[model samples]
Target: MSRIWIERLAVVLAVVALAGCATSKEKLLTHDDRTMLDIWNQETGGPAGSGRASRELLDARQALRRPLTDTDVQTAPGVQTRYTRTAQNEIYRQFHRLPNPDLVMYVFPHLTGTDPVPVPGYSTVFPLYQRVQYALPGERVEDY
Candidate 1:
């Protein structure tokens, strides 16, 4: 009887531990991960794998040219817009145009220390939201 009880408890604990290790599908992106664009083709399929190595290169170039500031982020209609206009523009101009319309742009305000004066900087990454089919062309197209 005691052995049976111990076995049940062990099984329950094992299940809990496994559950804790599981990560949601939504939370899958990691730092070293290749972008969605790199994995897909123009056909709108899953993970075709590898193309246009310089896509983010353009975005980086654009960011380097622009003054990355907190004010710039606040003034823009939204986060995505700021990236597309300022950072992405520079990237597009400097290198090949970004084919993915739904590209995600990230802007992070960081500091030297854990909590020092927030030194402003920006980064852009492709987001799944951009991949969603739009009703019409252009940003804020659904507003109409």
Candidate 2:
């Protein structure tokens, strides 16, 4: 009886596998796949039965073709008067710190005392300004 049950289970599994493989290979269009007319109708709030939508779109396009007037350009939401320069900002701009100049020095060969150990010649470099110092905007030329 157990052997008969095992054979029946195997046959059922094989049938299920074969059924899964029997699906059609054709591709299906999803709900999001829309035709151009569908998209146009959706965007324009439905078909322009009397061609009013097309006429309005054409009128808008033609209006865009004309050069923008000064008033139209200036009236944009992003167009605003420049903010008044704050005293702190002005001071910060005037006192902007400049990069310090570097100076390189080469030491000649020398000997140490006590044990008379010989020292080899070497070069050392250091910045001219060790601390931060601000200068007037036009006071110094930064052409280092």
Candidate 3:
């Protein structure tokens, strides 16, 4: 009976202690009476700081900033541009197109079907190789 009383007393004491430790929602969720601007001004020292840029500070920043001159930019001699927007460059980018020469064939006019309709002669081009071939970097792809 004494142990039971002690356990009950301990639980009651714990509940009371927890209640005292917990903050009330009203106090925790309460809005500040002072405006946000006023609080910021107090923290940043108003005229001295207050998050506004001064004319002298702006002038100093302008003095540091200057237009880039030709000498400021540097490029190595004999170094070429990596990529260019050209018909040949666009077709074969990153990998150079292998020397797959085109074979132009002329289609002689011929009669077709049971009706024997006349077809006009035309010229057609096809790569010697059925598919386009690409050469790896530093490989002999360009013609002499």
Candidate 4:
């Protein structure tokens, strides 16, 4: 009886370990394209081809779930009145329909004065998020 219990526990542990190892590869891939498409479609309907983009977005969103910090702004207050007029030029460069770039944060590598190291993990990429106004479902961008 004790042997049977031990075998079951061992099987469960092995399954958990395999699951963790299996997911490591997915973490390295870039799925942000889907996320961007989903947000764009949900806000503005473009074409029927965007369905795949929405699925990718859902996957990415699920993967990035984490506890929010105070500094993180889910929705920018006064996103239009404050940024729409002044950021018009900037918005034109970043997006076509909406000037707000808040859905996805752009991450770039930190520039160091030292020579670039070719080793595996010596530096990090920084996140740069552009704040954009979002509208609810079936709502127009101007409504925000």
TM-scores of the candidates are 0.19, 0.30, 0.32, 0.20
Candidate 2, residues 1-144: lDDT per residue as tens digits?
A: 999999999999999999898876563434567888999898886788547787887789998897879888977644332223667656545455777888999999999999999999999999997797876656665643
Off by over 4 Å in 1: 25-144
Give the least accurate 10-residue stretch of model 4, judged by summed lDDT. Answer: 93-102
Residues 1-144, model 4: lDDT tens digits:
999999999999999989878865567875565777677667765545456666777789999998767655545554544445456645543232344433344444454548864443244443343454544423443422
User: Which pairs clash inside model 1?
Assistant: 58-91, 62-90, 62-91, 102-130
Ranking of models by lDDT? 2, 3, 1, 4
Clashing pairs in 3: none
The Cα local distance difference test for each model comes to: 0.60, 0.76, 0.74, 0.58
RMSD, candidate 1, Å: 24.8
Tell me the tens digit of each residue's lDDT in model 1 across 1-144: 999999999999999999988988668855546565755543444333334545555567888896759898786767566445566566643232233444557667767886687868776766554444433223332222
Number of the top candidate by lDDT? 2
Judged by whole-model lDDT over C-alpha atoms, candidate 3 comes out at 0.74
Clashing pairs in 4: 100-132, 101-130, 102-132
Clashing pairs in 2: none
In terms of TM-score, the best-performing candidate is: 3
Q: How big is the positional error of residue 55 in model 2, measured in Å on the Cα after superposition?
A: 82
Per-model RMSD to reference: 24.8, 15.2, 18.0, 22.7
